[model samples]
Target chain A: MDIVLGQLFTGLSIGSILLLVALGLAIIYGSMGVINLAHGEFVMLGAYSTWLLQSAFGLPFLACLVLVFFMVAFAGWVVERGVVRFLYYRPLDTILATWGIGIILQQAVRLSAGAELRYVQTPEALAGSIDLLGIAIPSYRLFILAVTAGLLLLTWFLVQHTEFGMKLRAVTQNREMASCYGINSSRVFSLTFAFGSGLAGLAGALVAPIKSVAPDMGTNFVVDAFMVVVVGGVGSLLGTVASSGILGGSTAGLAFLLNDTLAKALVFLAVVVLIRFRPRGLFVDRVRR
Target chain B: MSRIKSPSHAWPPANSSAPPAAARPSLPQRASYVQILVYLAFCLLILAVPLVIDDAFLLNKYARYLALGLAAAALSLSWGYSGILNLGQGVSFGLGAYAIAMHLKLKTSPVHTGAAGLPDFMVWNNVQTLPWFWEPFHSTLFAILAGMLLPVIVASLLGWFMFRARIVGVYVAIITLAMLVVTNLLFIDQQRYTGGFNGLTDLAWLEIGGVEFDPYSPTFYYLTAGCLSVCLLLGLALTRSKAGLILRAIRNDVDRVRFFGYDVAAYQILAFAVSAGMAGVAGMLYAMVLEFASPTFMGVPLSLSMVIWAAVGGRGSLLGATIGAILVNFMQGSLSETFLDTWQLILGALFILVVLFLPNGLASLIDMAGERLGRAPPRARTEEPAAAAPRAMGTFNTKQRG
Candidate 1:
């Protein structure tokens, strides 16, 4: 029973991280209709940025998170203006271009930082473990869960309540209609892209302490993020959350029972089955052709 | 009816009135002449390079590139001709390599194994008896057959499900990528059977029918070159066949072809199987060239690199895809020596640039050059003759239809 609780908690934490990473992908894909393969690289960039800030400038972890978000967001904005803007309608070409961008980002980081893994110091306050009903859980893991929830709520509020979010949503729904109403669709696209990238950056920054920061680290996270976004269904935050929870909980539970490698294979197999059954995913939105 | 008929309703003015039979272009004849000349030159160069280049190492490297080129051409077959972008092409290649590598490992009979007639890694992993899977590989003929057949079988199975369900485009790419990841992980985890991360090594010279083929010798180079030539010719023949035409039509519009009562799924599966077979053969040669098989061969990066090769060479043309793989890999090799860090950066940028500006690739440039040199100034190189250029794939077709 204790083991089950521990596994459940671990699953929740893992799900939280997945949600954070996949949020940006869902948004970018939802609005821009661009499957950004380079989204993972943005996450890597965020992690690296946080590491640099914390190590070089001796900045607090929280301060680094804010800066990393802006920094990664700016990078995302540049990529959008330069490359992604041209291939909005060409879904296949956009995939290739973004994949190219991802390779460049990864290689650039490798060249600049060297191939060696780098570590980020976890905050001293969250270094210890907390006992809950006979289950010992790391405080940092709990903190990550809290941060992820807060960010999700914040994103929800922004999308639901803010005027800019309303404009972005309108543009995503129908560009011509939005433009007819005097909304600058291109600007909204760029801003939304930037915001999505910023969210990915925050996820990366938060994960840096748990996972070693490296140029190729994003490859692992990106696949998981894709699985989350894909299984959850595109264009729906609630679906993304639900799917991530299910996938994460199951994966953690499976890993506890089996080895890590076997658990991963099983998860992938499950995803394949899910995709086979629901090609459009769990919460597909109706659209006019 | 005759009384009601106006002068405008009479037979339309002869559209072909001015054209003389002698003056009119025989498009296929002219294009074939150029194609033949180009192929002859390529064949000649492949034969001549080893003789001209004093460095045996360079010759070996070139030979390896040709093997890789075969894999790229396979990608061209599936992606260019069939409009199926298989991102996990390396899975087939890796399977082929491992099959051959396993046999070679057994034949070499390297020392350090406690159990006689068993691979050193297996012995090290404390396997008391030979695994059932490795039994057939003891025979050289069986090993070679397995190398080619295994990947084809896997590809056909994968294609069966994917195409039958009408899963196309990015979904196919994602699924293939996932397969590659899974396969790589499996290869790494099964240490007892697969040699784990260290991979198969200490291979001896490949021998067939009492004849030994050494990796350093010119014979080995010729063997790979011969294999590549056969693959290219096969690819060319397939592209000219009736099935190829239908495949192209399907790529253009599956519904249209299906409406005509064609089994779209079967053709797709066939193309996929053939592509996998080509990749398998390439892998077999690759193992020979490198003298080992590693799990890295099944990696995502390698699979993507194959796509880049096909793209750069010109996915629209088979010969171009092969050449593209060779040229890009050669550039990578040479550039890495000079600018170690910047090579990948340059490659990434090149990939983006190619996708953005030169979607047709370096092959299209060659096509344009050849067209300019044609006796009759080519009819707008972009508007290639339908019979002369088999460039029918995906989104571009919609424009032609319009």
Candidate 2:
């Protein structure tokens, strides 16, 4: 019972991070039909933003997080306007183009940060451990879960309940119909794209404290996030959440019992098997293939 | 050269809805055995490059390219003709590499010192004994067999699931990319057995029963060249067979194939398996030449470069893919060595040029010139055109689906 509880906690903490990463992916891919292969790179940028504010300006980490969100969000907006907007209609092309953009971004970061991992200190308030019932768990993991949950609620409220949320949902369902109804889809796409990217940036900032910030570090996460996207299902939020839970818990939990390679292979085999049955994802949709 | 087969056939089509367009030209029936000999002669002349370079380093470089050429040919079999765009083919190649690395690691490690147990990396990473998985790899014959069979089994299963489920395009690519990542990470984390990031090494020369041939000896070069030749022959036979045509049909029109009562996934799995086996052959050759195998052989950068090689060469043309692999690799080697700082910028610019302009690939350049040459003189018109890119003219024959 204790081991199971411990495993579940670890899984929950990991799943929270995946949620932040996949939220942006789901929004952009689901609504706009753009994969944004460079989404992981945006997270890297957010982490870098945190680093810059800390090292360059000597700002506090918590304060820097908020400022970096807006700053990174604005950067995302500009990128959407400049490049990604042109690619919304072409999914495969966008994947290739953004992959090119990712390489360029990685190289640029390498030039700027000198091709090595940088250390980031977690805030003092979030440091140390706390007793969760009878078991002791790291406060940082608990903090991440809290912050991510809060952000998720905030994002869900904004999307599901607000006027803009209605507008965004309207555009995603039927672009031509929404436009015929005078919904201004272009504005919605741009706004949602920027908005989703900001979430990625935030995820990056959160991850920075746990993992070292490096130019090439983003490459590793980029592919795993793709797995999360597939396991979850493209264009489905519920699908992503379910898969993230299954994947995170399974991978980490399996790693505890088995060698890491076999664990990963098992996850891959699971995805392969799931894909065989569902094809689209673990979720079903009317659109075949 | 044929004066616009139809006025409506022009690209971007003067208009979008142009009556579905006409079929492209049929396969040219001009290659006699005489022309075939000339083509072979040209390829052989190019193969004679090592005689002139005379530098052991340079000969080895070309030899390595030849080995890579075999891998590229296998890749083209699946991606170019089959249109599966299997982005995780590198995983199959890596499986072969790891197999050889295991045998070599066990053979040369100082701790084990004998060729019968776990590698030193496994020992250092605190593996108490040889894992059960390592048991199958103890025999040289079984190790090689498993290397090939593992990828085949995995690919077939993956293909059966994916194709049967109708996963196509970006979704398929994304799933495969995820596979690559998960595989690489798994390799990295299994520090105890797989050597993690550092990977397995310290392999000595290989010999088979009373043969004292050193791995890096001239005999090895001939061996690799011979292996490449055998792979090429196998590829040619596969591509020329009825099954190959069916594979191409599946690529161009899976819906049509299903409509005609064909099991598309079966063919797909077969092509993927053949390619996987070829990759294994390439791996065996690579291990023999380098005398060491590491995770780097199956790394993402290496895998991506092969994709670029196949694409830039003209995925449709086997010769073009081989040429692309050699040329791009050679250019990268020389450019990185000479420019150091600006090589990436140069490569990026090259990628853009290739994507935007030569989208059909470098092989298309020859065709473009050949078309121009068709009008040059009466003398040139009689000289047959080289197979520029294997144009599956039947692909657009939508009626065949009936």
Candidate 3:
């Protein structure tokens, strides 16, 4: 029973991280229909930002997180304006272009930061584990969960209860109609792209302490995030959350049963099989036209 | 050239009152005379490499480049002509390499294999007997056949699942990329069977008809060159065939072709399988040249590099993709040697520039030059419809629930 509880806790921690990385991907892909391959790079940038801040400026982890979000968001905005804007009309080309951007970002990081792996210091406050009903969960894991939940709520509020959210929905549904009503669809897309990118950066910042920080580290994270988005169903926030939990839980469970590598391969096989059955994912958006 | 027919006929006439086939003007062939001449010239240039470059080391390096070029051409067949961008092409290439590497590993002398005659890694892992899967690879013929066939089988299965589900465009790319990651992990994890990260090294020279094809020999170079030429020619013929026309038509508008009662999935799977076979062959040749099959062969960077080759050379042109792969790889080799760390940065930037400005690749530039010289007719560029992008976006927003 203790083992089950521990595994469940581990699964939840994993799910939260998955959700953090995938939230931005889900938004950008759902809204703009642009497969931002460089999203992982943005996450990498966030991690690097956290490391740079802590080492260079001696900033706290929390402070680094706040600044990293905006800094990475700005980078995303530049990418959108500079390259992704032109390829919006060619959705497939956007994949290749964004991938190119990702390569550039990774190489740039490698050159600037040196190729060695960098580490971030976890906060003193969140260093130890907290016991809950005989289960000991790391405080950092709890912190990540809290941050993910808060961001989810924030994102939900932004999308559901704001004028920007309303404009975004209008633009997403019918660009011409939204434009007719004087909603600058392009600006909405740009902001959404930037916001989505910022979310990825935040995820990166949160993940820095747990995972090794390297230039190419984003590749695996991005792939995992993509699987979450794909399995969750594109454009559905509830679906993203649900799917991340399911995938995360299954990964934990499978890893427990088999070895880690086999577990990963099995999860991938499961996703592919699931995709075969449910092409649009587990949650279908009935509202989609 | 006379065998070339207008693929436009595969689609119904835009207007109900369109003229009969005979009454219509003769459509331009897929490749003009000048393009064919250029292809021949390119072939001649490759064949003459051994004569010009007497250095065995340089010759071996060129052989590897040509093998990569073949893989790029294979990619062009599916991505360029059929519009199925397989990002996991390296999976097939790696599989092919492993197949041949296994055979060579078995053939190696007892020095590498020890007394057990098992692969060095297996021995190291304390694996007493050869695994069942490794048994058939002992036959040179079986290895060569499996090198080509394994990727075909894998690709066909993957393509069947994907195309049958009506997964197109970027989704296919994502799925394939995911598969590449999965396959790479599997290959790396199964260190007992596979060589783990070190991969299969210390391979014996390929022996055919009692003739040893050493990596540095002119004979091996010719073998690689010969296989590449065959693949390119086969790819060219396929793109010019009736099915190829249907595949292109499907690429342009899948719904329209499906509406016309075509088996869209079948065509996609066929092209995908064939392309995988070519990539597999390329992988085998690559392993033969490099003398090892590492998990890195299936890495994302290598897979993406192949795409870049196709895109830079012109995915629309098989020969162009081959040239692109060769040129890019040669340049990468030289540039990395000269500038060291900055080659990847330059490659990434170049890839972005090509995708943005030269959508049709450097081959289109050649076409433009041909047009200017009055050597080729003005052909309508095979540009992706601008409406398709917005439509894809619109569908994502309002995708009908199944």
Candidate 4:
């Protein structure tokens, strides 16, 4: 019973991390229809930002999180304006272009940061673990969960009830109609892209303490995030949430049963099989043309 | 169609005059003449390299470049002609490498093998006998056949699933990328069977009919060059075929092609499988060239590099992509020696520039120059308009269509 509860806690922690990383991908791909391959680079930049702040400037982890969000968001905005804007009409070309951008960003990070792993110290307040139902859950894991939940709600509200969300949805559905109604579709795309990148950055900052922060760390994260978005359904927030949980829980459970590597392979196989059945993903939005 | 009359022609006085079909045929014939001249020139250049360069080391290096060029040409067949961006091409390449490497590894002397003739890594992992999968690889013929067939089977299955579900464009790229990660992990994790990260090294030279093909020997170079030429010619023939025309049509507007009663998925699967087979052949040759197989062959960098090679050469043209792979790789080999850390940065920047300003790549530049020199109106080539306006994958609601 204790083992089961402990595994469940581990599963939730894993699920929260997946959701955090995938949220931005889901938004950008769903709204703009641009497959931002450099998104992982945004996450990498966020981690590097956190490390620089905590080590160089002696800033607190919480403060770094807030600042890293905007910094990475600005970087994403520049990428969109500079390169991605031109390739919007040629969506397939965007994949190759963004991959080039990802390569550039990764190399740039490697050159600037000296190709070594950078570590961030966890907050002193959240260093301890708390006993809950015979399972000792780390306070940092709990903090990540809280942050993910808060961000999920924030993203939900922003996309559902806010004017920006309305503009984004309108642009997604019918760009000409949205433009006719005085909604600047390009600006909306730019902002949504920035926000999505910021979320990825936050994810990077949050995971910095737990995972080794390196220039190439984003590759694996990006793949996982892609899987989450793909399985969750492209643009559906609820789908993203549910799929992350399903993937994370299965990963944890499978790892416990077999091994870590096999668990990953099994999860990938499962996702591929699932996609074979549900091409649009689990929670597809029924939007009429 | 507007016809430009010659300055000698009295056009206003000839109401019953028919259009000059004889002149029309000559224009295209002249274009093909130029194309044949270029093709023969390329073939001659490849064949003459051994005579020009006496250095065994340089010949070996050039041979590897040719192998990579073959892979790029294979990529062009699917990506350029069929419009499928397979980011996980390295998976097929690596699998083919491993298949041949296993055979060569088994043929090595007892120094590298433990008691009972098990591979050293397997001995270290406490395996007394050879695994079942490794058994068939002992036969050189079986290994070579498997090297090509394995990737074809895997790619066919993957393409079948993807196209059946109607997954197109960027989604195909993403799924392939994901598969690369999975395959890489699997290869690395199965340390006991796969020799882990160190991969299969210390391979014996492949021998056939009393002749041994050493990596640094001229014979091996010729073998690689011969295979590459065959693959390129095959690829060129494929692109010029009727099915290839249909594939290009599918790339432009899949829905329209479907409406015309074409089984779009079947064509996609065919191009994908053929591409994978070519990559597999390249992989087999690469393994022979390098004398080992490592997991890094399936790495993201190598796979992406293959794409860059195709794009830079002209993904729309098979021969162009082949030349591009060779040129880029040759330049990379020399430039990295000087610039080291900055080489990737330069490559990335170049890739972006090509994708943005020169979408058809360096080949199109040559084509443009040829058209200018010929003083003929640009012919309606298959790749030009396809590159200009690519159809979005089926699922997305692209604004271009509406």
User: For every model shown, what is its TM-score relative to the native structure?
Assistant: 0.92, 0.83, 0.93, 0.92
User: What are the per-residue Cα lDDT tens digits for candidate 2 across B196-289?
Assistant: 8787677755555656335544555666666666666567668767898898777666777789998888888788888888877777667666
Across B1-402, the per-residue lDDT of candidate 4 in tens digits comes to 001111112112121121234446566667667776776678777988888888899999999999999899889898988888889999999999999999999999999897888998899989888999999988989999999999999999999988988877666777788788778879988999999899999899999888999989889988898888778777767776799889987776688789999999999999999999999999999999999999999988789889999999998888899999999889888774548678888888899998887777888887666555655533323224332222222112131121
lDDT of 4 at B399: 15
State how far residue B5 of model 3 sits from its true place (Å).
35
Tens-place lDDT digits, model 3, residues B1-402: 000111233223332222234532444444444556767787878988998889999999999999999999999999988888889999999999999999999999989997678988898898999999999988999999999999999999999888888987767887898789889989998999999899999999999999999999899999999898778777767877899989977776687788999999999999999999999999999999999999999998899889999999998889989999999989977664547568878888999998887787888787666555665432322222332222332222121112
How much is B342 displaced in model 4, in angstroms?
A: 1.2
Q: If you assessed candidate 2 against the hidden native complex, which CAPRI class would it receive?
A: incorrect
lDDT of 1 by residue, B1-402 (tens): 000111221222222221234543677576667776776678677867767776778878988999999999999999888888888999999999999999898888546344678888898899989899999988999989998999999999989977888777666766787788788888887999999898898887789988777877787888888888888878877877888988887776677788999999999999999999999999999998899999999987899889988988898778899999999889877774649578888888998888776777788777666666764333444345322332222243221110
RMSD of 4: 6.6
TM (chain A), candidate 3: 0.98
Q: Each model's RMSD to truth, in Å?
A: 6.9, 6.3, 5.3, 6.6
What do the candidate models score in CA lDDT, each in turn? 0.82, 0.69, 0.85, 0.84
- Estimate how well candidate 2 is docked, as a DockQ score: 0.20
Question: Predicted chain A of model 2: TM-score relative to the true chain A?
Answer: 0.93
- lDDT at A41 for candidate 4? 90
Among all candidates shown, the one with the greatest DockQ = 3
lDDT of 2: 0.69
Model 2 stretches astray by more than 4 angstroms: A1-5, A70-90, A161-167, A176-190, A259-262, A284-289, B1-27, B31-46, B105-119, B122-150, B181-196, B208-219, B336-342, B345-358, B372-402
TM-score of decoy 1 = 0.92
Using Cα atoms, each model's DockQ against the true complex is 0.28, 0.20, 0.47, 0.35
